[model samples]
Target: MPAVTVPDLTVLPRVSAPGVAAASRPVVSITSAPSGTEGEGFPVKRAFAGVDLSVLDPFIHLDEMGEVDYAPGEPKGTPWHPHRGFETVTYIIDGIFDHQDSYGGGGSITDGDTQWMTAGSGLLHIEAPPEHLVVSGGLFHGFQLWVNLPRVDKMKAPSYQDLRSRDVALATSADGGTLLRVIAGDVAGLQGPGSTHTPMAMLHATLAPGAELDLPWRPDFNALVYVMAGDGFVGPQQAPISAGHLAVLGAGDALRISAAQRQQQRYATGLEVLVLGGQPIREPIAWAGPFVMNTRDEVVQAFEDFQAGRLGQPLPHAEVGDPVG
Candidate 1:
């Protein structure tokens, strides 16, 4: 496969959302994305849960990984790790990812697929590109969201949900310009295939030029928008956010997102965005690496449990080639 070229996004000026009229339901705040890496050597642009995890409520972090081109012979993938007291949601847009877990869970998540893993009590897993893909080179793009469990569900048993693209519900507005795919919540009464114990909405939408969406949302949920592949106007004042920026919606009756044209007419091919929201847990969060609990003692206990081999054991997987990094 040929090398994939990922463009570097330019930082834009901050546009305040609070000044917009209440009816517009302007954005509460806009958070810029910062570059980072995860796993063995997976590069990412982090949108939230960097400086502070409190403001995001039940959500911990959102990472934009890949859309990168890997040359043939490149080796890169996530090694083994443990997670507890929360869930990991991954949405794949391109390429392939191989998943293995201590529960003997193994599968391939291809393009437009989603993997929702609940590491309730404990889980040890590894997610990485297929050995062939890493060795032959390919395009990779996806988003991984960390959702925090409330105190009650923190110790529940582990579970997994793999949603294929064909099964995911896609809804288009009465007009032709807007399209939406509900992955975890309901859209137009169409429920997503990925179910969650937590109350939340995970929507993937694409808008044509001049198309817009004004969706009704609960006031109590902490709503946020991450521009995935294009620029758009957000909130009431219509704050402009380019690809890679994540906007946290302010208090309002609903959300207003419009497909916007750039000064030079960007997004000629259209735009894509991910809308996520969840109810606030309003409880103490004690987090250390992969463990999230109610207090420091629980965090220490999680570590102790891992040390005692309480986390599930990982099963062996067939490998075409060994990953390099």
Candidate 2:
């Protein structure tokens, strides 16, 4: 869970607490992610499963890639695939990954690095462990989030952003008990490095055991908190939440999270969570395998375009690896 760290949290800028008049968001629901395999059988936890789409507007899908330690020659990743009408945010907490897309947006990202790929109109891409990582496997853990674009921007040109860990906006709770890594959007006046087509905020926070973080949030944006490791309580009611759980929050100007006094031995460091929110798109969403559109007909058209080779062709060099599965 070493996405980013500070030797002393007190040295970082402190995130101001919500104003006295601000209301704390309440936990509307808590759901556990279901385990599954993706992209050539790499393990994943479907973080958004069983949650209503309307409650997650602007966020289409999320996967907790793995916390697994792989033996040598065991690392795995996705095969070449096509995507449209959305952006894919791949954040690596540990280990390495190589990405190559048809539109010349590709790079190698390792621990604490992120690759933001906007598959606006469409594109073919592949993500896989590098050759050396495959030959000498180690721990690989990360998350991939699918952010849906508004109907107007569904056909926008594709773009890519490589965000290194050092570029993230770092902050701490006023009490210096938590480390905050702002990846996108603004947090307490601290702006993250990644630019987004949609108005949203994504952050990873680690709270020391027994610490509490009362974070100011946008009243107009919907809020969500996903526990990546350790245990904690969320919302004004202090509902219990643990690793692999997602908590949907109700309208409010602030979010409340408190770490338990004791964490699982493996998570002794603290409670690790990813907090995200966005202004709801409030538009119809027609999503199918790998494609997300505002209407079923558009989704069908996407499939046709992909099949007709209009999406894109795989780079000649990608052929050196496994053929598109």
Candidate 3:
């Protein structure tokens, strides 16, 4: 990706939301995505809780991302769940994530790890609790993104991309305080580790308090940001954000973010943001729980393949789980 020269910051206009005051200078818009039934109880009810569904084109769902100070005993996570016709991208900023799948795929993802899995043609999987996280805690958080599939590949074979922290390409700012790592696609002369089946870009960025960044936009795709930690400002809206918040950006050349942290503020230590975008596919969708496909026939085909023990045939490492006991 060619580096787009950073334009000089001048006359920055600040837009305002209801609660956020628009300070006509460089500011960030921060809004809390409401949580419903999914985050009812547990150490952090909203830990796994997120904004339910995104009723938009090219975007089907968005999770505000989540975090929980692991405790002695808590509901580790979701049991065996199923997904089809779409892709799930998991990015871990800190802590550990244990995952297993009926496709014979299972492993532990550590800090700064990204797992991009495509549940094409149907697949059953479970993300077991990270027992170690229960004791140690230091920025244990991440996001799970669901990208809809185009009709052509809705029934494509399932696949996975396990990206280690080191595998991603990272670039340090000129001042050396800000770090940008492209987890997928390309940015700043760097490319992400995981190979994407779709045209997508996912990045993990950390800005030291007081640092600022201006990111270029992809004209062909819709862009958005999810705040992982810190209290900062982002975009032309200049929204003030807290941790675990999601901010969708409008179409433009590039977006801007500020890492203005105050001494007295708690959780104000710069900002952690996930920038993502992808070519939107306006295709027919058939979704049911863990299954998603272009047509009902495709969904039925996937189910029949799994029931007849044929789905696992393609994945040599797939471990067939108990028959929905």
Model 2, poorest ten-residue lDDT window?
316-325
Flag regions of model 3 displaced more than 4 Å: 1-31, 36-57, 130-139, 174-176, 261-264, 296-325
Which residue pairs show collisions in model 2? none
Q: What's the lDDT for all of these models?
A: 0.75, 0.90, 0.61
Residue-wise lDDT of candidate 2 within 41-131, one digit each (tens)?
8899999999999999889899999988989999998877888899999999998999988889999998789999999998989999999
Error at 80, model 1, angstroms: 0.5
| Model 1 bad stretches (over 4 Å) | 1-24, 49-51, 262-266, 314-325
For candidate 3, write residues 1-325 as lDDT tens digits.
1111113312212221112332222222334655532222322213222332332335555554346564455434555556667888777665666777767776887677877888777777766456655555434456666777788777788888788887777665544556677888866446778787778788877777877766555566666676667867777666776566766665555667777656225554467777777777767777655566778887777666765665544433333332110
lDDT of 1 by residue, 45-112 (tens): 88784436666888887888876888896646776777888999888888888887887666888767
Please identify which of the two predictions, 2 or 3, would achieve the higher lDDT against the true structure.
2
| TM-score for all models, in order of appearance | 0.86, 0.96, 0.75
* Per-residue lDDT value at 254 in model 2: 96
Candidate ordering by TM-score (highest first)? 2, 1, 3
Greater TM-score among 1 and 3 belongs to 1
